[model samples]
Target: MTSKSERLKDEGSRLQVTAAGATAGLISRFVIAPLDVVKIRLQLQTHPLSDPLTHRDLHGGPIYKGTLPTIRHILRSEGLTGLWKGNVPAELLYVCHNAIQFASYRQATVFLHSTLGEGTIPPSAESFIAGAVAGGTATAATYPLDLLRTRFAAQGNDRVYANLREAVLRIGREEGFQGYFRGLGPGLAQIIPFMGVFFAVYETLRPHLTHLELPFSTGGALAGTIASVTAKSATFPLDLVRKRIQVQGPTRNQYVHKNIPEYRGTMSTARAIVQNEGFRGLYRGLTVSLIKAAPASAVTMWTYERALRFYISLGERSVL
Candidate 1:
């Protein structure tokens, strides 16, 4: 049985971890907001199934070409500010999402370790399961903000949202409450595997890399970047499906044809992409997605780990 002091120390550590996670999330998401904007825009790009010859022209034309071109176009058309569209909601989503996720992950990990005992399962497996649970919980809690962020980012300069309140009101008025959770199914599907692999890889690699004597932040960044790239590459299809589902509503621009029945739900969207555009269609923005995820995740995890270490040090000093 744990002593009272031990329990209090554990609680203190958990609180610190939660705060660190939130700070890391905010800074990282803000730094990569532009990349996130481009990635979402690319994912939301539509190709006409009825016209094979004009598909490239319609979907992959000058405006929605590769990442660099798309960036240039946004700059020329909407200026530097265009890159940071929806940043407010994105920041909110990240801060809340990470706080809940990392805190829950820590709690879950403790519970699992206590129940199963150390070494009963591999650390990597434990981290993976914990991450999945945390990710799902975080997604469920903050999904409304996430939907709004995606919609705002995908909107570009076409629609002006006065503020977060106005965006929420407009979505509520136009799409109803259900609109806030539009792509929840696909989002969870993607997040589970994405975060599972992410934490697993990070936990597995961190110890090995730490032996190299690199700074905590550097090691964290390296492990996080590699983990994020690997996980994102494997789950890019689900992300595309989620983005497509998220942008669907009466007020939003129709990325898919109204005539197509498969674009309506998660499974249907996957089926439609496979039927109309082949398997590759599901990986529409994989390159940009990976590019954005790697750096953003690196920064996020580095900050999280660094902040966690700082808090842990403080806790140790307090205990002393």
Candidate 2:
């Protein structure tokens, strides 16, 4: 009977993991979608082409004055649907990414405790390590999909990619296989530190909330906000680089457009953006990212943790 109960508990944990992951994806999207639209527009330098008056030369590449105006511009020109550009790919990537991120973090935390044998609750450092590993592993596995997602997002709100499958084929045919994984290195660089800070701050804050007697959901929201700010602050430069590489000039086969100078690879894109736009250019969307990321992370982590706890509770009752 004890063995059966344990088995039931294990199954419950797995179900909790899955539910938590799904909720994380949903929450992440809801929080990030608008900011995502702005970030991509900033990254793609969309304003320069769309409206002559709003564009300005900042440190280098074209810059927009602020988020509210930019959003207004997109809505005016592209309609309400413009705000959710590339939503399909974004949703797809979020679903897959969160599944791995949340589920693996739970398993990894358990594994770390077992392997270390100290078991007095894993340290914050352990959480950071687990998150970095999870983010890197998951990103590496699904990076090509992420690249496509970025491309779809970065295109102006007025543009469309037909479908993800069509976009993938077009990219491969026009840009070669390596194009599919553009900016992967910078993306990984951004993610490792981002997740490291994310989980580290979150773990640290969770206990503080428990001490304050706050509900778990409230604690989660607080921790996630802190984590998101810290993570995005540390990794914004790499994120800029990732965006640049992911949305480079026209592909080799697209003959209609005049050839902008070609970047040989991700390194070239980084060098070009830096040399041309200066350090500020490397953090093009930094402000908007913070605005978007804080709420997004707050909801994602809060939703994921609560969902996991609820599912686990249900599982336990069923076992009893």
RMSD after CA superposition, every candidate: 4.0, 5.1
Best by TM-score: 1
- TM-score of each model, in listed order: 0.87, 0.82
Candidate that would win on lDDT = 1
What lDDT does the true structure give each of the candidates?
0.79, 0.70
CA displacement after TM-score superposition, residue 319 of candidate 2 (Å): 4.0
Q: Candidate 2: lDDT of 213?
A: 41
Please write out the lDDT profile of model 1 over residues 1-320, one tens digit for every residue.
88423553455467898899999999999899988988887776655323445223443232366788878878987799989988998999999999999998888887777788766887789989999999999999999989888877766454646678997898789888898899899899999998899999988898777545554447767888889999999888888898888777775543222222236788888988888767777887788888888779888987887787788888889989
TM-score of 1: 0.87
lDDT of 2 by residue, 1-320 (tens): 45323443464465578677877886688567878978876765522223345454433333455788878866776677768777777777787788888777766776776677433545788889889988887788778777776766555432436678888887888778887788888899889989988988888887777444444447667778878888998888788777666765454212111122355465677677667666567677778988988778767877776777788888778889
Candidate 1 residue runs with Cα over 4 Å from true position: 1-12, 48-62, 213-217, 254-262, 313-320
Clashing pairs in 2: none
Candidate 2 lDDT trough over 10 residues, lowest sum: 252-261
> Candidate 2 — which residues are off by over 4 angstroms?
1-12, 46-63, 119-122, 157-160, 210-217, 249-261, 264-267, 317-320
